[model samples]
Target: MANLDTALKDAMSIDGAIGVALVDYTSGMTLGVAGGTPEIDLTVAAAGNTDVVRAKMRTIEMLKLNDDIEDMLITLGGQYHIIRPLTGPTGKGLFLYLMLSKARSNLALARHQLRTIEEQLEL
Candidate 1:
């Protein structure tokens, strides 16, 4: 299995990848980050997204839906933001956030690649 550093590097290699981060929703902290530009702050983005995750989770609970989230996608005019909540025991309360250029990325392939990386990630 790959460690955090390797996983982050692998994520950065995805076509059109701009930034990625491993974040803990429980505490809104970034455990690792890579490939952010001057205009994009990975840490801030990750922390901010914690609220989104939590909100979705709460909505699910309130609605009494017995389900789990795989990922959430945000489409901007020029970018695609992918937020994948980890499901492994060791990954509890954690997620991987990836940013990609809409013009350069193939969304389906990027999601598949991210899933593979998540499977191999070792904390």
Candidate 2:
């Protein structure tokens, strides 16, 4: 299993990866971050996304859906944002956030890679 630094580095190796972060959903804090350009502040993005996760969780609870979220995808004109909540006992309340350039990224492969990284992550 990899530690946070290795996990973040692995995330940055994905095709078209622009940035990645390991964030805490409850506290809106980033545990680790990598690969963001100056124009893209990963820290701010990570914190802001905590609300997105929280909202979705709240919606699921209110709707009484027994399902769990695997991940969330946001497609922008030039970018794809993926939010994957960690599920292992040590990873609860945290998520892996990945940003990719739409033109260069293979969505399916990136998702698969993220899943692998999540599995190997040691928290």
Candidate 3:
């Protein structure tokens, strides 16, 4: 199992990864973060993305979709942002956010690898 430090390091190792953070959706606070560039403040990014996750979840509940969100992908001109909410008992209300260079990242592979990392992460 990977601790927060190990998991953050592992996230940084992903191809094209620019930054990664573990955030609390309820409070829009970051629990852990790694690899952000000077132009990107991961703490701010994580907090903002918390709203995205909350909005989606609220929409789901309102629509009575009876579903769960696996992840959210936001593609910008040069970046790919991935937000994955953690679902384990201890991980509830927490999420993992990953930023990747669109030109270099394999979206499918990154998603798969992130899933693996989530599973191995020890909260």
Candidate 4:
């Protein structure tokens, strides 16, 4: 399994990855982060996304949906934001947040890569 640093580096290797972070939604804290520019602060972005995750989860619970979320996607004019909650034994309560340049990224491949990263990540 890959450690946090390696996982983050792996994430950064994606075609258009601008930044990535492992965040704890429950506490809105960033456990690890990599590859952010001056225009984007990965830590702050990760923390803000905690609200997105929490809100969706709460909505799901209130609606009594039996299904679990695979991931959440937020598409911007020039960017794509992906929030994938970890499903592995060691990943409980944590999520992988990735930001990509839409023009350079392939959504399908990015999703697949994130899944693979999730599986190998050791927390």
TM of each candidate vs. truth: 0.98, 0.98, 0.97, 0.97
- Identify the runs in model 4 with alpha carbons over 4 angstroms from their true place: none
Give one digit per residue, the lDDT tens place, for model 1 in 68-99.
88999999999999999987778989999999
Candidate 3, which ten residues in sequence have the lowest lDDT sum?
83-92
Candidate 2 lDDT at 82 equals 97
**Which digits, one per residue and each the tens of the lDDT, describe model 2 over residues 1-123?**
989999999999999999999999889999999999999999899889999999999999999997788999999999999999997878989999999999999999999999999988987
Give model 4's clash tally: 0
Q: How many clashing residue pairs appear in each of the predictions shown?
A: 0, 0, 0, 0
Give a tens-digit lDDT track for model 3, residues 35-76.
999999999998889889999999999999999999999999
With a 3 Å backbone cut-off (N, CA, C), the pairs that clash in candidate 1 are: none
